[model samples]
Target chain A: GAGVSQSPSNKVTEKGKDVELRCDPISGHTALYWYRQSLGQGLEFLIYFQGNSAPDKSGLPSDRFSAERTGGSVSTLTIQRTQQEDSAVYLCASSLAQLAGGNEQYFGPGTRLTVT
Target chain B: AQSVTQLDSQVPVFEEAPVELRCNYSSSVSVYLFWYVQYPNQGLQLLLKYLSGSTLVESINGFEAEFNKSQTSFHLRKPSVHISDTAEYFCAVTRNAGGTSYGKLTFGQGTILTVHP
Candidate 1:
């Protein structure tokens, strides 16, 4: 089975420009998450989507960051008016389901965004 | 809020030597623990997890972690390591929340393990 996949492995854009990163979760995965990894921040959760319920945007650092999951499969994370501080590796993960204890998350290669 | 702390930032060991990476977490409620490994230029992979039942969990690749509730720790250990074991290890935690969980993981500052031949 194919693991989670992300498009545009690398993206470089101007500081004020907007960028969208895409993610394709594994088949049958009902939960998807987005995280950011940077040299200073380590790894930080950005957002999560489960089934059709409203997405968990609690982890979004600021209002400029947003994400949407269409048809419960593919997810897109959009950053508006990106800043140099937003330059980081964006990783996508998916799990079979969100259980009480925990569910293993499969990760993608990640899209490295560089805000110039 | 939950937070994870990995004591060591880097561990350099000779091949075939025992290794231990310490991890401690702080949370007001029960949580699930996990160890993730990332080889250079690759995505993170699940190494092992401690959800429930046994306090000790083992991975297929000779790695094991023991969940210590009292100590609030889940440290990874291996009797012997190989050169291929060199990678960055991250310890993460998510709240149990009793029922259907939608919590995000709180990851530690990764520990880089460099196995020397």
Candidate 2:
């Protein structure tokens, strides 16, 4: 793909339900990241995937949040028992390299998740 | 761990006026700095970055940022602003320590720039 892409641009879910956000990174990009942005708040790191594995899952707020990548390509962020506080924009980013240093991330359009 | 601080939450200015958005960071080790801009209903785009070399870095959109190591700041500046410049700006940092860590950026609360006609 020319740029990172995300699906279901907008999603409205009820509290206690589950929601899944998806991201398709740039073709051949090796690194992928997920972030949550609340109203009037900064981007909060959630999880990151390198290839088909995730080495950095420390940012996930709780066990209700989980993510996985397959074939080192697309990724899905699943929030189980979604809470009202989970209403935020879910963003996905990709980078050419997997190293922590000396890399620039390309971001996707982001999925706006609204929990009612 | 690293953190980013964007002092201002919003900055309003007239078109053709100069603008500056301040950003600061705290980290024990060396880090890479970056600035990104997000237009309305869009994803963030890289504005500029300070990876190495001269402390000052520039973007083609007439925006520049200076990486001040001593102050741990990477303030973005534009000599003149335009209506098109109205957007949200974010500052981010990632530790430079070599390891399995992929660049997980720690971002600041964005500053929304509103340019008046």
- Which digits, one per residue and each the tens of the lDDT, describe model 2 over residues A1-116? 38999999999999999988999999989889999888866698998888989988998989999999999999999999999888889999999875556688999999999989
TM-score of each: 0.97, 0.97
**Location of the lowest summed lDDT over 10 successive residues in candidate 2 chain A:** A95-104
Give lDDT per model, in order: 0.93, 0.92
Per-residue lDDT of candidate 2, residues B1-117 (tens digit): 999999999999999999999999999889999999999978899999998899989999899999998999999999999999999999999988887557899999999999999
Q: For candidate 1, give the lDDT.
A: 0.93
TM-score of 2: 0.97
Which candidate tops DockQ? 2
Off by over 4 Å in 2: none
For model 1, the superposed segments whose C-alpha errors exceed 4 Å read none
Whole-model lDDT for model 2 versus the true structure? 0.92
Identify the candidate with maximal lDDT: 1
* lDDT for residue A4 in candidate 1, whole number 0-100: 95
